[model samples]
Structures are given as C-alpha cells and as structure tokens.
Target: MLYKLWRSFIKEIFLLKRDIGGIVIIFVMPLLLIITITLIQDSTFRNLEGAKIPIIFIDNDHSEVSQNIKKELEGSKTFRLLTNFNEKTAQDAVFSGEYQMAIVIPENLTKDLNANVDSKVQTIVSSFGLEADSAQAQKKAPKAKELHLYFDPATNAGFKSSVMNSVNKMVFEIENKKIYKAFQEQLGTTEDIEENKNLISFKEITPLKGEKEIIPNSVQHNVPAWTLFAIFFIVVPLSINLVKEKSQGTSVRARISPTPYFVHILGKTFTYLIICIIQFLLMVAVGVFLFPYFNLPAFDVSGNMLSLIVVTLFAGLAAIGFGILLGTLAETQEQSAPFGATSVVVLAAIGGIWVPVFLMPEFMQHIAGFSPMNWGLNAYYDIILRHSSISQVSKELFLLFLFYIAMVAISIFYERKQNAV
Candidate 1:
C-alpha cells in the first residue's frame, strides 16, 4: 500500500511538472495578484491617512455661525472645503463618483438660533439620490433651514462615520456658543466659556490591555484572501487531471492492481496537499519580504506560530478535499473546467475574498459564514490581527476539518457509485 501511494504521488509530481500552464496559474498568478492588489490598497490607505477628505461647502446662510463652522472645518486637517459650489453640480459630481460628501448650510440658520427655534442642517447624501418622479424628488429635497450632508453610497462606512462625527462636533460647538451667549445676555455678564468645558464629556475604553496596537493593513487582508482564492482555484486543474485519467482508463488499471482504492485517493490528496503548502509558503514569503522592500506594510504574525501552522494545515486540507470532490463528480475536463473555475470565483466573492464581510450587506454577511474560504480567512485573521493562540482558532479549524471530511466522503461515495455503474 505504501509503495503504491509513493508511486502515485511521484506520478502526480511528474505530471504537474509537465503541465506548465497549471504551474503558472496556481503559483505565478497569485503572486502577481497579491503584489498588485497590496500596492494599490497601500497607496489608497496612505492617501486616506495623509490627504484631507474633499467636501463641497454651500453656505446659503452666510451668517456668523455658518462662517464659524466653515472656519472650524478649514482649521481641522480633516477636510478640504470647496466653497461656492452649485447645488445641482455638486449633487451630479457626487453621484458620478467625483466627490464623496457635500455639506449645505441652510438659510436663516442664525435667525432661528437667535430665536431659540429648532433648526436642522440639511445633509444631502449622494446615496439618497435615486431616479424618481418630479413630485417625489421635490418631496425628498432638503427643506428650508436644513443642513444637508450628501454622501456617496460607495464611500467606506468608517470614513463616512468619521466625517459625520467631526461635522456633528462642529455643529454642537456652534449651538453651545449661541446658547452660552444667550445665557450671558440674560444674566448681564460677559464671561467667556472655556474650551472642553461642556456639560457632558466622553471617554473611550478599550478591551485590550497595555499599549499593544493592532493596525492591520492591506497586506494582512490580501495575502490570506488571495491565497485562499488560489488554493481553491486548484479545483479546476485537479478536476481536469482526474477526468483525463478516467478517460484514459487509468482508474481501471489502478483497480486491477493489489493497492486499495483509499490508497490511490489518499495519494492524490497528499500530493495536492503538498502543493498547497508550498503555494502558501511562497505567498507568505512575498508578504514578509517583498512588501516591506517596496515600502509597503508587511504581514505581522505576532501570534503563535503553532496556531498559524495548524490553521493553514486544515485550510489546505479543506481546499484539497473540495478539489477532489469536484474531480470525482466531473465526467470530463470540459465539464469540470468551467464549473470548477466559476464556482471558485463565485465562492471567493461571496466569502469576503473580494470584499470584507463587514462591508458586505447584512444578508451576504450571514451567507459568508457558511463559506470555507471565510473560515480560512477568519482563522488567518485570528493569528495575524488578534495575535491569538491555537485554542483561539479551534472553532475555525474544526469547521475546516469538518468541511474536508464531508467533501472527501462525498467524493468517495460518488466514485464507488460510478465504479458500480
């Protein structure tokens, strides 16, 4: 049995060496994708950190309070304010992806504040714009004295939240000043209000102890995501190989030998498992050495090395099992090629390889939990981001093992059924 297994493994290795296209797709393509994606994302993150968010400022009020608000925004490095922007033109620009957010200070803002009447600043988020009837559009448009903040739908939620928080703070300070001035006039005193002396204060509390900081960058995300994508993509070539063997009567020849069927299957699985490990190591090397060489963030594996290894083992097994299952079920290379390739791409997209699960819709996030790629990504993140130990990722590892077992069992059952027929 051991001899037969060894022979099968060696055969697979030689066959793979002959298949130049498969080797390039499985190894070279992933390296290129990871480098390109990481570079683009690193640049984007740097710009976001260094450059100010551009916003259109339409001050119809032109009052002292409105001017102060504008001054506050300008003083803070958070925003680059573009003034005297036409409302229609701004809205069009935002919708067309030229801008992220727009702020409109309404008319009579100061007058309403002086009278102690409640006034709303209109926020016209570009996301709110949609094709609608004239009456509906008119009804949805910003009313008088409303401060409208228009936001693009495609903008990152975290970025939008940060911008909103800053805007709200500015508005709060403006209101607080007006109220303080009113109180001073009523009390016949001209005392100035001190900074940061508001009635309410906010404090942030974090769960992490000590000064350990975990700042994950694009390298941390893309390396594991594209790795999983590449691993699963092996299904295409693997299925093709299996179909070719069956068409050439290799299966029948193997059955006639003294080796058990499980040995043959295990041999194939073992060969692919080794391939996956090598692929993973090559990708990790890129993250560790190549990224930092280009002035980009490198993979920070501050967690237990044992934990990373255990998760990676199970992830490779799960991916290999899936490939084997596809190989067994496929009747021909033509049928399996498209099915394997398309399924891997679709699963990767759904499993947060293409986008973070947090950024996905609520329904999609729920669906992502069931994906094998998501489980692998979660395990990797546990080690990379959380700096977790082996026990921390036990659940993810367990799920991956379960996926592997299920796929292998199904593939075996299908093979037996085909043999009987």
Candidate 2:
C-alpha cells in the first residue's frame, strides 16, 4: 500500500511539473496578485492618513474666537485652512463642490460672547450680595451668536459630522474659557485655567501577545488574505485535471489496477498540498524581502513560526479537500472549469478575503461563518496579527479540519455510490 501511494505521489509530481501553465497559475499568478494588491492598498492608506483636507475658513468675525479656531485647525495638520474667501465666495465654492466644507464665524462673535459672560457674572455677583456695583447685572444677555457651516453637496455624512463635532467642541471650549475668565475678574483672583487643553485625552491600543510593537501595514494585511485566496484557487486546476483524467482514460487505468481509487485521491491531495505550502512561502518571501525595495512595509512574521505553519497546513488541507470533492462531483472539463473558478471567487467574496467581515452587512457577516476560507483567514490573522498561540487559534483550526474531513467524506461516499451503480 505504501509503495502504491508513493508511486501515485511521484506520478502526480511529474505530471504537474510538465504542465507549465499549472505551475504558473499556482505560483507566479498568486505572487503578482499579492504584490499588485498590496501596493494599491498601501497607497490608499497613505492618502487617507496624510492627505490634507482643504476647507474654506471665512472668518467674518476676525476676532480672538475666529483666530483661535484657525490656530486649532492649523495645529491639527489635517486641514489646509483657506481663509482668503469671503462669505459669498466661500459659500459658492462649497456649494459647487470645489471645497468639501466651509466655516463662517459670525461677525461680532467675540463682543457678543464677552457681553453675555459679563451680564451673567454680574447677575451672579449681585444675587450673592458680594459686590457694591451690581447695576450691570440687569443688562440683558446678548442674542445667541450664530456660527455657520457650509458643506459641499458631494460631501459624505461622516465627514460632515466629524467637522461639525470638532467645530462645536472648539467653540464650546472657547466660550467656557470666556465665562471662567469673567468669574476670575469678578472675584479678583488671577491664574490661567482657560488653556487647560490636556485635562482629558483619549488613546487606542492594539494588544499583542508579543513585545514587538510593529505597526500594522498594508503588506501584512494583504499577504495573508490573498495567500488564503491563492491557496483555495487551486480548486480550479485540480478540478480540471480530474476531468481531463476521465476524458483521457487515466481514471480507467487507475481503477482497473490493484490500487484503490482513494490512494489516487490522497496522492493528488498531498501533491497539491505541497504546492500550497510553496505558494505560501513565495508570498511571504515577496512581502519580507522584495516589498522593501518598492518602499512598502515589510511583512511582520514575528509570531510563533510553528503556529503559522500549523495554520497553513490546516488551510491547505481544507482547500485541497474541496478541490478533490469538486473534481469528484464534476464530470466534464466544461462543467468543472467554470464551476470551480466561480465557486472559489464566490467563497472568497463571502469569506472576508475580498473585504473584512466586520465591514460587511450584518447578515452577510453571519453568512461568512459558513465559508471554510473565512475560518482559514481568521486562523491566519490570529497567528500573524494577534501573535496568537496555537491554543488561542484552536477554534478556527478545528473548523478547518472539520471542513476538510466533511469534504473528503462526501467525495468518498459519492464515489462509492457511483461505483455500486
């Protein structure tokens, strides 16, 4: 039995080696896919982080409040604040979509704010009977100052909300400082409390099991995701090869021989599993060595190498199992070729290969759980990004194993049923 299986394996290796197109499809094509996608996504990340949003700042007030707002915008380094345009021109530009948004600080904003704070402070002093000259306490509060924001019609709601929230917070802080200053003057106690900007702050942390604090980058993200895709893409060639065997009487000779059909299947699966591992190594090599030449981030494979290899093996098994099942179920090249290609694509789509599962709609995210690719992807992510130990990624790994077992079982059952007929 061992000799038979070894011969079968040797035959598969020789046949695949001679098929130049198959080698290219499994190896060269995947490398190109990963490189191209990583480059594109890296540029997108740079644009999102480093691109300055140009916003029109129409400072009709031209006072401390407007100037402070301008200072804040400039300090953020997020906006290229253009203050030259007047109300009419800025409004026109924003409405016409030449600019994403505009901020128009109302005129006399400082004066109105100061007057309102003074009147309120006087009222407080007079009510408390703490001051002799409290006649100004009766002065009515100035009408509410209006700060106008104009947005381009093409702007998304997310950008609009972010701009509005930032502006509101800034203006609210300025107003509070003014009120605090009034109280300080009325009480005759002097200390600067208004400039306390860092009184509160926020931070985000991505916890990893390892000490290395590598920033997540496009290459790290794309390499694993597309590697999973390329692994599963083996279904196409595997299924076609099976159909071709039947057409060319290869299956007939194997069946009439003393060797069992299952040995042939095992040999094919083993041969292609080796191919999957090689493909995986090629992708990682490109990310680690070649990407730096392109000025892209290098892939961080700093986690447990054993865990990474374990996950890759399970994922390869799952892909190879599905390929064998597809080949067994399909009868003709015409049927197998299109069906295998289309199935891999559809699986990739729903499996968080094309997009992250969290970004999908709720129902689609739930559906992703059924895809074997998703299970493999999650396992890969755990090992690569989270630095997860084998125990930590056991659930996804178990699911992949079960999927592989299920596919192989179904294929064996169908093959037996057909043979009995």
Q: Which pairs clash (backbone N, Cα, C closer than 3 Å) in model 2?
A: none
Query: 24 in model 2: Cα distance from truth in Å?
Result: 2.1
Candidate models: Cα lDDT each: 0.80, 0.86
lDDT of 1 by residue, 303-413 (tens): 455666677788888887888888888888888889998999888988889988998989999999999999999988877777777788889999999998899899888
TM-score of each candidate structure, all chains considered together: 0.85, 0.89
Model 2 regions lying over 4 Å from their true place: 84-97, 123-127, 132-146, 150-157, 194-198, 205-212
lDDT of 1 at 38: 88
Best TM-score goes to which candidate? 2
Per-residue CA lDDT of model 2 for 261-339, tens digit only, reads: 8899889878888888888888888988999998998887864566877888899999989988998899997898789
Least accurate stretch of 10 residues (summed lDDT) in model 1? 117-126
